[model samples]
Target: MSKWTEIRDGMVSALDVSDVVESAKDQLITDLTGDGMDALSTVADKFITQVQVQAESEQGWCMVRDKFVLPLMINGILWAVKLVLAKSTPATATQPEAPTGDSQQ
Candidate 1:
């Protein structure tokens, strides 16, 4: 077999062994702690809820902005201004019409 083939096989074997070792470690931890999957799941749930609440609070515009309405109005006006500018800008002039000529004599 080629050296390359041998190397590929060795890498695959190593990955398989690593996976087994990690699985065993997780099982050992679960068994020793007795917290098992249920405890882990509850912690995960609380973490998710806290993250959601924090995200919502942070995203509340009124809390951060003194004049939230003004900012939204300004944004709308800017968007409209951009749209008008884009519409008024002339497009590149069309290519000059090709001369009318019969291709086949």
Candidate 2:
């Protein structure tokens, strides 16, 4: 894809990351309603707006337009990243284990 917008469009499909956006939205709503959260509810509202703005095709997340090298939707992006990291080593994340050798041949 020659255009940045095309790459952005294709990446969502190629990487199958569309669900991540939905997941983030759900998480935001959860945070908005849930108690004992570290931050205020209004932060979630701002993040939700950023997620919507980034998800829009017309917006398409451009640096020139949005002035972002880190992306305006970075909270959602970071949420997905944190999700991936959390899932990456579930066993180890929850419980400590001895550093062992590979099980497979």
Give per-residue lDDT, candidate 1, residue 9: 97
* Cα lDDT of model 2 by residue, 1-105, tens digit: 469989898877888755567556555544533442335335655765675576554454553344344344555655665565445433533577876887777
Per-residue accuracy of model 1 over 5-37 as CA lDDT, tens digit each: 999999998788545665565455545334443
Q: Model 2 — TM-score against the truth?
A: 0.23
Candidate 1 segments whose C-alpha is farther than 4 A from its true place:
1-67, 93-105
Report how far residue 39 has shifted in candidate 2, in Å: 18
Model 1 clash tally? 0
Model 1 is weakest, by summed lDDT over 10 consecutive residues, at: 85-94
lDDT of each: 0.54, 0.54
Top-TM-score candidate index: 1
TM-score per candidate, in order? 0.26, 0.23
